[model samples]
Target: MYRVLPGFHQIQQPNGSYFTVPDRYINLFPFKVDKPFVVQAFDRVMERYVVIKKVVLPDSFLDRQPWKRAQRELFCMLYIQDENVVNMYSAFTPAATREEMTEFYIVREHMQGTMQNLSPPTFGEHRTVKSIFFDICRGVQYLHAMNISHRDLKPENILMTRDGDVKLCDFGHSNMEDPNANTPYIVQRYYRAPEIICETMDNNRTSVDIWSLGCILAELLTGRVLLPGRDHVDQFILMVRFLGNADQLFYSVMNERARNFLNTYREFLENCQPPTDIHSHFPDEVFQGGLSGQPEECRMARDLLFRMLVINPDDRIDILMVLSHPYLAEIWDRNMNPDDIPQPQPPEALRNFFRFQNIFAPETLRDEIFNDLREFGERFNIFTGSKN
Candidate 1:
């Protein structure tokens, strides 16, 4: 049984152990709207800490966007299980009935801090950065192989454990890889890909994720955001300035709106020439404390970044290629068997749910979510809703 205390929530397991979660959270930002409230919990059975993410469901029936995003996040987490990905313990609603359910809860393994929040000294060593980046690549590679794209991959979404293990989190913006999927407004502006801004994504939805990874890598090395665009136009202009003008092939693929924008700012873009030396952006002092400052390692890192941050999506390095890159060679296991790799199999129920276009109705979505919860409860031998 699960019950709420005056200032805390308690969840009882069938094994006679319990989990206690306080009402307050460590990462609460009152000014930030729409952010989920995450609180740490103590699991008596495991004798370890966990995180409980509280998601408030919209009251209005007409608003189903948030509900859909939450459902998508849950399904994505269930679909992919990897060492570099955050692990979900369980999920439930405390409300006895669907009508009374105003909030949903997701319990997951505890992480020390996010890449964005951790101090620079934590990543002062170059090998540490490489290892973290390598883990991220592995996670992305697994997702891509499963035909999923993590639309939002930023420092804030990269979680780090106390043991220095890196895991990817926040799948609210994730979706199955579809070339024609028109959601250019997905990733954060700073890490967004050029093709996404141009709205020219086609047959390569994963490329956007790669672009985001490049931005994250740059941030890890320099201790700041690489492309800090104030707005959509600024982001595109900055990208052009760094990578030079878009090629004929790239221009040919651009939509009319993007083309118009380019023509409007053609003069300004021409003045912002590409840098002669990309290495200047990453200084030796940043990696000098560790062996990562070696000339050979620095060259490999720069070369990898160059390939990843290409102006054209078609020219960008794919996730698999990134895993095989020489920079990540130390972590790549040569003796690993192909059969040992875990393949993602999206649930049949989820596939069917997505097939219905008109299922966005609030009532319909609520029912589907409840059904999913019921199924999860059965598999995990946990209580999700009242039997009565």
Candidate 2:
């Protein structure tokens, strides 16, 4: 969390309507997203402290394809640099196109919150929940080693800083597609993932992000909502009443209109009764309130939440066995492979353009984002962590 400044002496930064570069920075919550008041601002011209994201879009039918959902989250954070990913320094968007109506800010590095408010009464220590689930499973194992598919992992897209550390943030329903193409994809109905609901999901959609990181570590070890589904058929009836009926070749790629709604959820799980295991719905006070009264970290967090709450994405549990799960082997780091990590360089074809019916203005979106931060800052390595 890089602070240590009172610099930029006389102060300025808050003048608004963005990127003709006025606002010297300072709005701190006037609540803005579509109404556009403040997503937050504070630079005073690089005196530090950032974060002011936006990729606004509206006119909807099925999809205008909001510039391919803002180029699958700025090309998956411009090709996945890690330290648990989330950086983006600058991408002002005073321009407009793709059938007009645009606004796309991007200035990141600002945290100390979210993991959905670190579960219950603002979760503080308790041995930093295995180093914040080993920095969110090493940021989803560096986005499945770049094959990418963060189809929305939950816990409000995990962020945390006041020295806690976790990162992965909103890859607007990320891609590299095919997680068994059934279509209607948009996670977060209790972290969806029954092959994103039997459109017969096939393409190992990164095991539907390991079943939404085991429902975000079972809602940070029981701050509740391990499967609090309210839609998508009550999130497949609370995941078939807690990981129960799933294999008939997992609905043989469901397409008889979702295999007749998976045979009426297998006749409503054969008249509801036997279906609870995952330590009988985390009984012992949800592992004595998030790994506290430790019984070997609640028996390795109930065997890593039954191998990450699998209803079957080919029997989930991946992020490298969740970074060697022994309840997160104390933030393990077996030199995280993938050619010694830190990626993010291949992107240049018109800076990976995704036909948003070309329009642009603010001086061509500030000369194609400062020529993509000067050709990806002279090639790769832009991590911005240790608090950018």
Candidate 3:
């Protein structure tokens, strides 16, 4: 059984445990706007907040669950074992009320908004992208120093306070440095490494995280998802198009242990050749490269991005080397203050734009369809009623 306590209007679980912010808060504010909402606890008087979550595991997944309560226990232990990662004041199991039933939750300190919200200088935001990448590198370096792999890293998971400091979050799907391994690879499909799909067959570690970060770096520069795809298969295809396809030698590069693992998936990868001339499929300007910034610096960033988004995750750079990369050093040497960065206005005015369907084009017929769907859902109770 778990314990729960009252803190002002919010609830606290046992030390070191994480519980989802009550649904009331889960779909609130910026978090609500973002899907797969994050949990947070807010204090009105102190102007402080805490992140809390409870991962509800389905009973049917008892045999196939990738991690355990003990793994979560160990995740809490990492905060104690390493300091480079974010600080966790406490982490313990706690009781959560769900209707008439009660269960456990996970809780941790709440970090602030992420770089996704930060607007760079209109004069040239690419420099701001370079500066932000340094902060990301430092945070990632700290995680690697502690031998932890933040496998699910993305802009949303990387929190940036108003003062411009950075903290990496979302360790639920991370890989801890452990000698005895139990599960296969795990990551959000878009950011997932190819080794998980192709060669190692899901044996993931530090290198996989570096690859994900690289993709994130590219996205930050362009304000778009670098390898956006509809689903895992689409993402994999996009990856092959941007980067070359996995070679036959990829499996041979692994050790005997991994090679033995590859035997099971050889036939699958053999037929997994990506479409030829993937780069040619990209928009002409995307390949022609007309963005701002020193061409050399831009090229450097692109080269690093390419290496990280490779078809083979094993070929990607690790945290240590990324930290040592000249691009990072050059960016940091520029001595940028996030506050001083200029923000360019959106191309079109949004004063009259409706909030519910904040899609790019309001005139498009899809907006009308979406507005109708929203109205129907609200009137007919197509979706669940609000928890509050």
Candidate 4:
């Protein structure tokens, strides 16, 4: 029974089970019902506060007979060791009578907001791209140093506190070192390294994570995804374009059966089309792939990002080299001018480029667009190549 301030309150369930009621409630900001939420139910009947969380693991997770337990073990270890990691207070197995029984609740300490929530498009400059990436790098460095590899490191799994610090969560696919064992096949396809995708990363799971790290950095900077693809096939097409054709290692991951499956789709893969012109709002003049930031300070960071997005994981930069590079130095260098830092802005030419003289306007707001163009005047040179 849950201990209340003066007495005990029994929690009755819609199902047959019963539990204790909490003494006090803690508000989880922006809580969603089925998805990750904020409000946490807690009890502090005595001097100590007890918090409970309801976690449900799908039954499908158990279908993978080989890796189900392993995945759980990995998550449990990672969760408990890393305080920055999502904290799980307890867990309960589902009731035995439930059909398709894939439910279990993992009680956890509720964290504040997700990285997506913190860095919403509407939120103005607080943590710049550089700082956000540095924090990520530090977290990654820790994971690598501990010999752990987070197979899926995406923005969705990144949790942010009220103070704005980021914590890497979701270790469901993470891998820990086993000296006697070889690295297992792991990685979320989109963030998947070229080597891993190509099967070249036989034991290089760490590099795969680094590749995702770079993609994440680029997204934070632009507020637009750098390598967005909807599915495995779409992602593969994008990667091949950047990385070229996969090597033997890439083909090695698939069994003959899987290879045969791919062979059937070979014709379709060959016919896939690339975007006519990939639009990067980044001005060509300002972006010198190697010349950005301080040559001695931000070089590693830049090069690593460039490499991570490379079509081939085989050619990607190793995180060790990335961590040692001078480019990363800018992360901690305070002497740099804040004003010199590059901020995300639309191209100068695009600002006032589109001007419609209200010719089609109901004769009302037409003037507003023209007035805006007038205010923009010569300061904004809008260009539409097709208009010519």
Question: By TM-score, who's the top model here?
Answer: 1
**Top candidate when judged by lDDT against the true structure:** 1
Q: Kindly list the per-residue Cα lDDT of model 2 for residues 29-142, writing each as its tens digit.
A: 433233352255567656776666656544353443454556456555655566777776665333333233344455677775667764445344345666787778777776
- TM per candidate comes to 0.80, 0.34, 0.61, 0.58
Local accuracy by lDDT, each model? 0.69, 0.59, 0.49, 0.47
- Candidate 3 wrongly placed segments (more than 4 Å): 1-30, 33-37, 44-47, 55-61, 64-74, 77-85, 90-110, 117-125, 177-185, 251-291, 331-388
RMSD of each: 6.3, 17.9, 16.3, 21.9
Give the poorly placed runs of model 2, Cα more than 4 Å off.
Answer: 1-42, 45-47, 52-62, 65-103, 106-109, 112-126, 130-151, 154-157, 165-168, 174-194, 201-210, 215-246, 256-295, 298-300, 312-388
For model 3 the TM-score comes to 0.61
Model 3: residue 72 alpha-carbon error in angstroms: 3.0
Model 1: lDDT equals 0.69
Write the residue-wise lDDT of candidate 4 on 64-142 in tens digits: 3223323343234323444345554443322322232223333445556667677545323323545556666656655
Task: Encode model 3's per-residue lDDT on 1-388: one tens digit a residue.
Answer: 3333332123333343334333223322224334332356553323346554444533332332322332333333233322223544333222223221233333445566676665332214345665667667766665555455666777666777665666666665554454344344466666666665443533446776777787777666565667777865566556665664577656654456756765665565466664454333332234222344355656656656765666665567666566556666566464334333322222121112212122333223222323433443355331222211
The Cα error of candidate 2 at residue 54, in Å, is: 6.5
Error of 3 at 156 (Å): 2.2
Query: What global local distance difference test value does model 2 have?
Result: 0.59
Error of 1 at 102 (Å): 3.1
Query: What is the alpha-carbon lDDT of model 4 when measured against the actual structure?
Result: 0.47
**In candidate 1, which residue pairs clash?**
none
Error of 4 at 143 (Å): 2.8
